[model samples]
Target chain A: METLFSEMQGALVVMPSGRLDTNTAPEAEKMLVDRIKGGMNQVVIDFTKTDYISSAGLRVILKAAKLLKGSSGKIALCNANAQIFEVLELSGFLTLLTHSDNLETALGIVGNPA
Target chain B: MTFRTILNAAFPPFSEARRTKPREMLFSVAEKPGIGTTFTVSLQHTLIVLTMVVYTVIIGKEIGLTDAALRGFVALEIVVMGLTTLLQSLPTRFGSGHLIVHTPSVISMAAFIAVANSFGIGAAAGGILLSGVVVIFFSGLLPRFRSLFPVEVIGILLVLLGLTLVEGGVQRFTGLHEGSFDTPTLLTASVTLGVIIAFSVWSPGRLRVFAVLAGVIAGMIVAYLSGLFGASQMAVVSSEPAFAFPLGNYQIPAPTLIIAAALPQLLIEVISAVDSIGTAVTIDKIDDARWTRPDMQMVGRTITAHGAGLVLNGLTGTPPLGTSSANLGLVAVTGVASRIVGTATGIMLVVLAFLPQVSAFITTIPRPVIGALIVYTAGYLMVVGMELILSRLLNSRRQFMVGLGITVGVSLMVMPELATGVPGHLKPILGSALIMGVVTAAVLNQIFRIGISQTARIELSGYSAAHDAAEFLEDRGAAWGARRDVISRAGITVGEVLEVLHNEHMVEGTVNLQATFDEYRLMLLLDYRGKAFKFAGDQTLDLAAFLEGDEDEDDLALDAAMSQMSGALIQNLADKVSSSSQKERAGLRMEFSH
Candidate 1:
């Protein structure tokens, strides 16, 4: 698995490719926590390339959401496949974060693009 | 342990152990009653079997046989009934090892009369011989066509059999003598029915086993007092010889095979075999508390015995024999289903054939009394048939199969003229409600099975994922003709697995659900790009501790608890559960026995 980070509308966009399971979750968590600590708070995780998620991967996203919430910054997720979306809905994670079917709507949820 | 100690441990003493009987049965199929109990029960069955000899009498009269010839024919029938009944109760290659009594078949009576009318008694005998061979041949093939006679189809056969008896039962009960209601006959029938119901329901211990006998004796007394049993009926009994050989005076005719006579008889024999199947199923179900499906092997043995009886009938120039449904009802009501009773009854029948006067006296049983017995048996059969039908998971296809099958059968019963326009030879198939109903149900069952695939697929995702997965399995299960209980379990297991997959964030793409079903088992496969579920050995969840835990720990505790619950539910619901993962893709398989 590979984690791709980019900037869109002043928001950090983190795209995870392949599976976001136990083997890759720790690395994804480390990268997100380091960026948030460096004062990049407004974020959107794009899951267009990611096809699987486990409880470990869910914990990584939950930790990032908690950190952003403490900083009073918004975080959103976009482009998650049906399985990932179902997982988020069933786990009660959707209550803490905003999500959209596409990246543009997700970026708008975090901050308006220029 | 030593060998002696180990052997003693494995096998308990008889005094320390008790064999469990089915709740409905007093004496099970394997249990043997004492001589006194056996004799009385056998006598009750013998009375019921004797009443069916009126069909033989009718056929004899129709065929214009001499009075002495008619007596010989009736004697031959009684002998065949006895031998076949005895054969059916024995646990041999030919017998079903159940209490299946044999009697002259009303279907064969009609076919024989037709053949006799067209050709002669010699040709009729030859036709019966051919039909017997065909019946035995068909018995071998019936087990292969097990899928055709599903529970619902057998239900239709049973219901039709009950319905067919209603015309005669109600007529005799109402005492429609000379197109007028006879008060005496009605009173006698009511008393007979009343005593039977009372003894069956309220009587205690050994008294209950003699319920039918009590009812018959009471009915006979009522008939004698009401002038229904006059000196004229007694005269007929007195005129019969005290003891005579079956073939002493009557001459045997050389049977000549005729295609015109044998073809219709062969067709009717096939339908009669269907009746034997229903009887076999009824007796099998009565014997076992946890009967899941028809024991086709035993059923084949039953038909084999029935065919053997027909073969004997052919050689002796008598009417073909069938498994008696009335005796089955008697067994159920009296709670005595011992095969020994069957043996005793058969012996009594053969003994009665020699004592012609005794058999004549039994035939003098009032029509109303016989009617009451038929009504009781009809009620029992119809209820049992309905239970069998409801035992299956019915979709629209199955509903139509059962509904239309019954409608066709009942239609012929209500409108006898429906077969009047058909050719004379086809009347046997189309005229009889039992034959038409079973044929329609079997054919419709095959027709409705056209588009139903054994395997089905659906994509399950989103908030209603679990619900959607359950519904998909149910619909497909019904279409594949799976048992209701098995299908329901499958649905519940799939729902539980889906909940786990969704709640644990286990899948990242749509979960593709695929189901495959054969008669014996159902298999479900779920594939998705996801993490394999981690089923922890420990399933116990500390609800109290989780409730009192810190908020951060509470969420983690709930997640662990839900995963444990999912694993436990999946394990209990399915016969087998297996999971496999390759790289990023995961698969879960659940199997349920049908």
Candidate 2:
């Protein structure tokens, strides 16, 4: 998985392409953690280009959610396909996180003050 | 096994299984359905599916998924299976429109288990999803990869898969989980096998349809009588609800595991797709008088739907689905391959999915009974593999490759110590005998390609057959160094032959094309089980009709004129065109030079 970082409304928007699993999770986790540590606590992961996600990928987002919560930060997931959304729902991540159908909606969630 | 032995042992007769002449079909694809007959036949199909649904339960237990999760997963799996069957049975561009039942595939279980064990269930789920994507891609570029898998390789894989399942089944029978090899369990298995064999051979008409169910019931009776069941097992019947909606829990898979496990999964998917296609082709041969190869468009689409089904399985946390050859065999035995019956079967499954109580009841079947069923299915699988190997001319070279592949696979599978020397990560591939066999067969297949002709073969079906065949020829010809004009000419010639065949009342799904490319020329051999094509010797081109023709000319007239023109064009384009027919197999051989 390769993440292309962009900013909208001062919130970092990360778009991941290809797969988000064990092979790519480490790089993705480090990138997200580094940004959170660097004080860019507001994040949105765009999954439009990413077609696959496994448990290893889920753990990264879970960790990020936990990390951001301690610092009063927010994370929003956007553009998840049916498979990804179902995975998130089954894993109980949907209850713990906020999701939007598109970047515009996601940015609104991430832009709000905690 | 020898070819004769396989034929004799197809389903192993207790009293010489009487050969039922392939039943005459009561309904054709185009025939309208009767409510009573549709319901009756559909019920039979439903029974077969119910027997197969045990796969999901076994797989769920094997993977250590929670009970609730398993139930929900099975619910979704049943629904997907129904929808897939409906898609396949419908007269769609991508479906075979045959009574092909889609269910959780036993062949892929070994790979799924390996992935689950190595990474996690989530990773296995991810791998299943990835496999779906891979299949969709494979559907598009089928010809290029077609050579990689032969009947011999698939045969090895199938036999290995059967052995693996049989091993699992025997372990279950011996109560390895409970660490016992008691008399009760032994009696239960024996009775189940006995009842199924008795019903299959001695039962009359529709009673044969209930053989599997009856056998399981009989085994359960024996288990209960033998005091195998406890109050705890029976108590769940009342506690379970009558109905519940399917709610899938989610677990994202590991990418590394998905990638690592992809090779084995992809191989399994390819075999499943090919097997399903073969089944569809066999049905086509039986259903139509002018049988061509299976419709490639429909076959490809059906495969894509199957892939989509797998993705659904992953999203729902269920095992991957494969086409059930047992159902295909049912279609043959029962002679009711109607789409309406398939639709009814699908609806029945969807209804059953919502009935949690029914699922709860199925769970009560003794482990030994399930083990017996698995063993029976595995026996059929082994025979199916041997039949596939024997389908083609098995030269000594092929015999050696098959022997080597099987020996290597079984050795690795039977003896775990052989894989112990391998590293941890690679164990998924090296550890399992099925994967080992698959890799071996695929590698040897590639290596033994030296003496084989450099040819590409594709099965084309439906109205799109001509177009896809044309495109395939042009694409493959270009890849083999044919000039643009030569490729174009070759494509046109192939299209023309198909058009001529169509004109002769050839149904859309019966054309197979094999093209061999050499330095100087491209030799295309087309086969179909239909009326032989011969160009009309007389050319009656009406210049007056052409001159007087208006834009409002009848479409029928224009079609007739164009059809006639195609024959002449084919003659002009190809240097030599000849056709021959032996028995029911018709061949059109055309040679196009650069």
Candidate 3:
């Protein structure tokens, strides 16, 4: 349930380590959403260390995505494990979201929104 | 007002509630015993546990097994018991890591004897081996079907087993005649029992733990003097080779005999699983420091090991093995609750298996002495069973289940004549009081238990985090027939709540969740011993408001946003949510409606 918050290329990089299920999604949501509320729009959610993500986690990201959309801001996911990727794909979250294979690509995607 | 009244008024509603800290024990689960101590303690354990070898002789003799076959059986039993004890006592992947000795189970012995008597040795071996496989297969499925054999049911079975053992002891002590007591047998038994009691009462530290062994020895001496141990027996002992391949020329029992013995063997093996689990729990309690409710994983492994041991026993043409409850008491009394001791004991047993002479000497111990040991051990088991039953709050339902089991079990055991009129095949199943009682208890428990079987309490340790909790909800919700969408939402909501708690560093406590389902809604009731949790309020983002914010204003807004964000997802997902806290504990109730 540890989240590392960093800023690179004007986008907040939110790396939540461990599970992103009900037990941890709240902290993750608050950390990411607060950054968005603080006027940082572009974001990269690094899931390299996260092994599992449930719908509760998806909801948090979806909620943040909705808020970011209102402000013309964007969010991208990078380094997701198969389980998280499957969860995202099953929910059609990938359709609404942008994803990258690694942090550098995520930074590129969020830095230059297309 | 008087001074006392004035003082009481000033300190109104004072209570004497005390918080209990965790208990520490003299020896912990991880502690290793000294090498010197391990050998001495193991020797003491080996001596007492050798009684099982004597039991094999009694059962083997009745089955008319050849001396070589008997020797092979005892030797193989010793090795298997030792190996299984190592598996069970060592804190390994399979062992319970407690000071429990594995020995040939009397229940299995009885089943084999009955089967061999009716069908032949081959049938008995087949039944025992098949049952072992069944038990091994069943161990994996136990968690799912655990409700069928709850504490109450197992407790009743244990009590019945104890009573039955005592009954068998009395029968042996009274000789062949069921109605009359034999003077010589009674005297020998009395002397054995007296010596055991005396040693238990007055034997010094360490020696007291070997009281049973000492008593058996004393009984043997008395029996020899009384002409029970004659020249013929001495000749047999002298003729036994000092060394031999334990099972070199061992005869395999016919597989057809196994088919005939299958039903009874299955029944015995089923109970053996129950018995092993109970023994593991009892030993865990005996080794109190590292104790938690019998770790289901350990219990499962131990039961599987029991079956595997029985399979080996069948192959060796010996009896099935079980965790010895008497050895647990010995461990407690000796204050040597170490896996090292158990491992050493297992090794010694394996060595003993090769020594035909040693096995022969053990057989020389008179029948009355073995009977005395059974009576003493059975007495302990009966009390343990009674204590287990009484430990819980028994309602009318439990009373009925226990009463039915005891009444039926005791009657069948006490009245063997009832089986005389019954068919031969049914005798093994119906004739035995213990088996009958087990079935009665299990059936009654299941019938009564159906009323309140829907809810389950899952206690989460400090290590369990959000995903664990969410998975629990998802699994239970699915099982409870909740729709996928509802299950999904509930899982997310709980996961988010736990995450918030974890982030606040409020995760240093146990979390318990109770889930209940009905037609309208799925409810999750969460209780934990930690700081109270509050759902985050809604903080909808406004671009215009953010654009106009001061530099410091953004920081303040973020804090407000953080507070609001906690319950945002849960609020949108669940129909209703409520939380309350009292003292240091907190409870949350959430209901997800379709």
Candidate 4:
């Protein structure tokens, strides 16, 4: 799996490709934590290219959400396929973090205040 | 726009939903087989159809037509069957564009004879004409009543249709002559049936497609050797003219309206139309592997073609025609369901009508061979019907719906005397096991549907709350006929929510679980006198800080993190979730799209 990182409207956009299961979740978590530590307070994870997610991936997102919240920052997710969205929903990630159907809305959500 | 254009717009040729071809089928509805394959498969279909024409001959003989006139009548019936079969295979406003063959209907034949015996032949034609109109009208209304025919009901119709053929199939297979079995006839039928089965099961590739034909050949040879096809039958075939015009010795009957004859004929035609629904479904299922539900639009078109054929039969002063299930069995055995074959078969039948000698030769095919074919078809229909019924998740209500339906249908077949006291007009509906069983099943389905609410509730208190909740959703899901996967997902989500509520100590006393299901979605509500969950908003637990805990606060931080994880899990499982509170009363609602 490859993870793409870019900047859109001052929010760090992180896109994970293929799967976001246990094998790739550690690398994805480290990248997000590094960006947060580097003062990128606003973040958006776009799942347009991602096809799957497991419980480990969910834990990584939860940890990122917690870290961002401690700094009074916001994180948003977008473009999740049905399977990925189902995982997010079932894991209760949707309740804790903002999500949108597309990247524009996700960026808009994260760029703005709570 | 022209009338045909208007009709096409009203009823499209194909269903809106596309279907995948079944893997078992060698040729599907839209597929075109090679010329040789098409002709060979068409020949098999044509032979099956020729066997069915015995009904036409019987109707003609019963009506006391002279030999010359009877020949013309049979020819006319064959021509109508060919035209209708051709129409049914074409993608026209009237055709279903499926490999549906038409033949003289046994159900309509008895009614036709009864009308002819009571009134004149012209009156019988008039009655047949009326039935044609009624059937066409019913076809338009059939798609609207698709809900009336669930999978199980169609299954019942198919099973009963098979059951109804049992006596005929068995009698011919056993070669029962009067009270005693004919040894030669039994031997011939066994050879034919055995060959067909062997070729179908053991043979590979193209050989399977000609199983029925090979069986016929083998049976005929056995029959000839056993003296079943002696010089008498040979003489009968030789006496027929090599070629002759169908109308040479017969005049079209002048149709005259007779209410007594037309009403009964109309009623019987309506029932026959219902029978065609089963045939259409069988053919539809045979061609498509991803078959979820009946394509009612195509079924309507099938009935339209059927009714139109009856109209032709009326004009031609011949017996009423129906979609042939025996030919459907032939399609199943051959694994070929190409409309091209249907078209070719139609043309062959029409051509054979002008070749009296060929039709006579086909008519001389040993009875045991035809019987073996019917028995093969009967077995296929019964098995396919059972598969259809078992496809759905059956609850007690649906179980009764299928069980009672089959019981009622089988009862009529076993003890036909049950309909002895019924009025003559109602006999068409009540006397026949297929009609009664389907009617009973359809009616009982509606009756059983009553009082079965879309919403159900259960109380969850002790240790089995999660298990009880899953079981509750499962039972209600089956009753609602919801998709099994959706039901399974719903059960899992509900169980997770109940576990969270109990483990988190969010609920104090008994929790009332209410589930509401519609075709589109399922909503689950958990109501209890307990603490409402704090949904994730801006709140976040610093897991790193908690793990590196200042000793005494570690347990509290761990508890908070665990609670947050559980909340996330529950929220993610459902498509939408919300919490409601009034004083000590709290409720959590979760919705899942079906």
Scored on chain A only, each candidate's TM-score is 0.95, 0.95, 0.94, 0.95
- Per-candidate local distance difference test: 0.82, 0.68, 0.70, 0.83
After superposition, which runs of candidate 2 have C-alpha atoms over 4 Å from their true positions? A1-114, B1-70, B105-127, B171-181, B229-231, B248-299, B325-341, B422-426, B453-594
Interface RMSD over true interface Cα atoms for each candidate: 9.4, 29.5, 7.9, 8.1
Q: How many backbone clashes does candidate 2 have?
A: 18
Error of 3 at B27 (Å): 5.6
lDDT of 1 at B325: 93
Q: Encode model 1's per-residue lDDT on A1-114: one tens digit a residue.
A: 899999988999999997675457779989998999899888999999986665556667766766676677778999887656755665556766778999999988888532
Worst 10-residue lDDT window for candidate 2 chain B reads B11-20
Find the 10 residues in a row with the least total lDDT in model 3 chain A.
A83-92
Candidate 1 lDDT over B38-68, as tens digits, reads 8988898999999999999899889888889
Model 1 alpha-carbon drift over 4 Å, by segment: A1-114, B1-21, B177-180, B531-566, B581-583
Report the alpha-carbon TM-score of model 3 versus the true structure: 0.58
lDDT of 2 by residue, B1-594 (tens): 897675333212112111223345556654656787677667656766666677777777787768777777677778888877776676654455567778778667667776677777777777777777777666655534545655567667667767777776786566665566878888898898788778677877556555666776788889999887767676886676788885544243434435666666666666666655555544554466443223444455567667777776666556788887556655644556677787778788888778877756666677788777767767766776776565444455666778888999889877999988986545656676876786787787677656555699999877566567767875665344344456655765676577567655753357889999754568999998876666788544343344245534554654565455555556666888888887777888999764
- Model 2's alpha-carbon lDDT is 0.68
lDDT of 4 by residue, B1-594 (tens): 898787765566564347788766898888899999999999999999999888888888899988899899999899999999999888776778889999888777777887888898899899888888778877877888876877788888888888888899989989787799988889999999999999999998678899999999999999999988879987888898899987657779988898978988888888788888889899988988877678788889889888889889889889999888899999988999998999999999999999998998899898998989999989999999998887666898988999999999899889989999987656767787887899899999889888989999999988667657768887898897665656666665666566667666888989999999865578999899988866877334444455344434433554566566556666666778899999999988999866
Which ranges in model 3 have alpha carbons more than 4 Å from their true place? A1-114, B1-31, B35-37, B58-64, B110-123, B171-188, B198-207, B220-233, B253-264, B289-292, B453-594
Candidate maximizing TM-score: 1
State the DockQ of every prediction: 0.02, 0.00, 0.04, 0.08
Q: B100 in model 2: Cα distance from truth in Å?
A: 3.2
Off by over 4 Å in 4: A1-114, B1-9, B424-426, B455-466, B481-594
